[model samples]
Target: MDGYFPGTQSGPMDTTETFDSLVRAEFSPRTSYLNTASNGLLPARAVTALHEAALMRAEGRPLLPLHENVETCRAAYARLAGVPADRVAAGASVAAHTGLLALSLPPGAEVLTAEDDFTSVLNPFHVRGDLKVRTVPLERLAESVRPGTALVAVSAVQSADGRLADLPALREAARAHGARTYVDFSQAAGWLPVDAAQYDFTATVAYKFLLGPHGAAFLTVPEDFGGLTPVLAGWVAGEEPWDSCYGPVAELAHSARRFDLTHALFTYAGLRSSLELLEELGISAVHDHAVRLADRFRAGLATLGHEPLPAPGSATVSVPGLGVRQPELSRAGIEVADRAGNLRASFHLYNTETDVDRLLTALEA
Candidate 1:
């Protein structure tokens, strides 16, 4: 993996230098892609892995062997999230995992969450009419926790305004109230160091900052989590799925693997490749580089008489003025998102200072 790319260095390099090399080695210069919050651009190595997986499938290879790729992906995600590999479960999407978690919670429970969080986090609990759900501002989340609160669910970073949640404080408050904590790391996982160990449950969509294909995601649950019942039980979730088919009683896996749903095997292979690249580059370096670019973009927007939202330590920057200009900017080969009436530009390792300049130039024009 050291020399997987041509001219790749053997040891660590400066973050900027590594990013420049990554831009050259991984991505094509077709457009200034600053929409990682919406969908990430897959690196060349990940694409190659996907291609090879497709070729194997075309050659009539069994999908059973690819199950190992799922474990490999789970381990990679666990490493990134600073949790044990056994605590991780592969899924098709954040919604699937959240729904499964919702089913595991006590009936008629009270849940607290942020209104600005992604819909997947809120919808699952909402659809379960038995639970009482309350939405509050992210800054007030810690204070909003009460004695009756059964679970607190929120995103590590708000997708709408790029606001990061005070996860440590929130976790502490939830724990004080004897409530469990759940975090959606879809926007923060690759670019921000989110320790999944801090929360009782954590979920991520691999297609975003993880830089993997769509339809692949994972969830992490605590080792001692009780009330372990699988609402959408499948043979794969069983401890001995092969033997369970012939038995009268079904025994689920003791670990978080019991929560896993069926997923695309090739997607896991692609995710493993991207996760390995992330590990090699180092998440802290990626976070710093992305934050620097976001800061630069925000400062430049401010100088141009636009106010970008203040979101420290976030790769995404939201500019209200640029929301209406998104279409024109897209025509100029600049990619960004108009999320919830704010124009958002999300930076990643493949982005550079030049890309920020291009975005500022497009906005100014």
Candidate 2:
């Protein structure tokens, strides 16, 4: 059990080595994959891990190892998020994790949100019907936090154009107004450094920048549980799950485990490998490498008279009015997305200079 959750420690590099070896050994994309914002390509290790887990099921082997994989991922995410392992809860849907916060808010309380933030971050609040879901432009979110704001919900990185939220500013405003903050990190984690300790709560799906499959999510919460009543609590959320199996849970989990939904066991089996690979590479290195590629793409777009959405320091570049070319690019063997009328391409540690140049060449043709 102690071997389940591993610590993240990448020994110092003396500058002679590069991430080239690790990436080359781990990934072999058949096409130019620049769409990590939509979905990341799985590393070879994760693919192998998934296949093994499926085989275990086919052989009717004990699921204890796969169960162990969930703890490994949760711990990895906690270290990546700069939180305690006990503070992170495993789940499958970010919207479902968000529902905990939405349901916690009293009637008529306001949930301040960025106008175009991802829907999963805002939908839970709206579905509550009793909570006031206020929308302002992403740039105006921090300034818009008022005394009426009970919670400020926003994506750490805008899913549409990669615009990063002013988190430090938002935190300050929320504190001044005695409000809580919920940040969705689905678009930024793994490449952009995340510290969930700064916000009241944070949710991230493992499929995007984290380079894992869909259906695995992690949520971090305050140690005191932030007064959140787990409305969907099942037996897994019990203090002693096996003992609590037959009753209305005798005692809820003392930690954030109380918020745990059933683990996506298969997803977790693969995600453990993904998280391990990310930790080995280091987020700072990944950020610098990806952002450089994005800047290169932006420069190329400028030369082509194509202005991208203005998002400095982001690894994702979205070119407005070029969404119509998505199919052309795809046919040209480039993977990207047409998001909200923009051609969105995200660069990851696995992407190369050639990948960026190929997209530029396609755009020029």
Candidate 3:
């Protein structure tokens, strides 16, 4: 084990000069990776941590540290979300957490949603079948809230085109109508400067902008657990998991941990390091860096006589009818996504102006 792990290195590893320095230190993308909306590249630290974790499992060493990694990731995400750790529940998917939220609603309750939002956000309500699911254009979500609307469920950032929801306006609208809010932060949390505290219920997957691996998702609920029953609660949701394991859970946890599901321990081990890297970079700085890159891409597209989807301040830029070029671009070592006939390219803190220009040059060719 001693030889398997490297000696601990301290300090920022020379990150003080600029974000570019940190990016240079942590990553070495072989391509101009412009597809964070798909999945993020892991930092070197996270990859190394994961490798060591797997080796520990192979050697049958103590895995108790893996559990500790889960709690560290939970707390770090709470800080990123601007909420107390006690209110956040760690889970595996937004859809699973939405099942818990769906159970809290009475039959026939009206659920307002955005049209074409990620299915992970929409499908859960549809599965309930008894509730009324209403869809409106993304721009009309806030104004669509009305009396009898039991819940307002939508993604904070549209996954298809990267348009941002009007969060402040949406929050006010939900309050005015007595409707509760559930926001999917899958595409926004890491670099969008969002506050989970602003919404009653928020769920985010860490693999996207957060740069964690898959199999890790987070749900934040109000102090009262939003009146939702933890129908899927297992031994982990008990006040004392060890003590309650043999019985019907003598006492459930009083906090959001009541909804706790067993985490993917090895993934969590690596995610702990990923979250540490994100916290070090600071979300505000990441936001500016990503949005700046996206805008630069959009301007380049305009000069080439192609217009992108009208996403004013999003970190994702999607050019309409240009998706046919995706194959050629990929062959040239530029990574991007083509979603529903739109050429989609999302930027993150690790990307640079040079990456943006490489993609533009490829698209022009």
Candidate 4:
């Protein structure tokens, strides 16, 4: 599987130098966080922004500038996702935006998704009394589309298996059934390529893979879906947030800005800094770096008599024999996550092939 980048294989690049050295070699040090999608290591730009935001907050400045920052970030993110600024919505988290979208749908509408969908997806459908919820295996999503399916929710990369879904095919099936498509891009946004205009709504958590702080997220709603209401409506969604009286909810901002829960200057400042780091690093190259490292990792694990997931082009590697591999690899400073009966190792720009070899050699011992 292509984890980092498929069809791009050179030799192991140096990783022993300081993290700062690696960052300067490319772009900002923050851009090289190998665990960006998992733990959200902050980028340098975001760090600076957070500092500025914190200082402003300490001085008791108004928080409205954060709303403007969200708007600016939305426009910048739209460019990255190849969509217009109006199609994006900045929010505190994916769950917050999902709540907004769920409110807009019919009361009794049906929501379909894979059983492996992330936890936030269950919030809207499971809590509602009238919404009909149905879930099948991840493999069945492609063929499960039918009438009455108001929305087909999915994760672009399954957090459980790190498998990348066939987005185009899913989009086609959802469109055929007149169902809206919602993708949780928390796992796919930074490590891989994503386009929001292709789907009805794509929610992204900036903390994951984007190398930003927590509580920063974005939702992309197509112009056609403008009728959807914001469940968490506030002064932000109104035509003029400072307006004394509420009006028609400001028509939902005509952009992702409608999803903003409240103005959060410090967090937004941090996230914007991380976005700037990504802009400097060139995502195409970043994808290549991650794929190469993950490929080597997978190969090394295989040589040690462990089998990874069967899919191709996925960065996640699942190693069996936990008792044997975990302790040995841990001693070598290699950390991995365990999920769904598999040992998961996620590779990103900061990882190197040497790190892979080190883990495999530990297993050999």
Taking all chains together, each candidate's TM-score versus the true structure is: 0.93, 0.95, 0.95, 0.85
Cα error of candidate 1 at position 307, Å: 0.8
Name the regions of candidate 2 deviating beyond 4 angstroms: 1-18
- Give each model's whole-structure lDDT: 0.83, 0.89, 0.87, 0.70
Better of 2 and 3 by lDDT: 2
List model 2 lDDT by residue over 8-53, tens digit each: 2233322414456677789989899999998998999999999999
Ranking according to TM-score, highest score first: 2, 3, 1, 4
Question: Per-residue lDDT for 104-185 in model 4, tens only?
Answer: 7787898888886788866776777788888988778878989989998888888766778888888999989899888888
Clashes of each: 0, 0, 0, 17
Residue 157 of model 4: what lDDT? 85
Whose lDDT is higher: candidate 1's or candidate 4's?
1
Candidate 2: residue 153 Cα off by (Å):
0.2
Model 3, 1-365: lDDT tens digits are: 11111122223333435445566789989998999999998999999999999999999998889888988998999999999999999899999988888888999999999999999988888998999999999999999999999999999998889999998999999999999999999999888888999999999998999999899999999988888998888888888877877868879988888898887988898899989988887787778778878888999998899899999999998888988888988998999999889999999977878888889888787
**Residue pairs of candidate 3 with colliding backbone atoms:** none
TM-score preference between candidates 3 and 4, better one: 3
Evaluate residue 121 in candidate 2 and report its C-alpha lDDT on the 0 to 100 scale.
93
Candidate 2 global TM-score = 0.95
User: Which residue pairs collide, candidate 2?
Assistant: none
How many pairs of residues collide in model 1?
0
Q: By lDDT, who's the top model here? A: 2
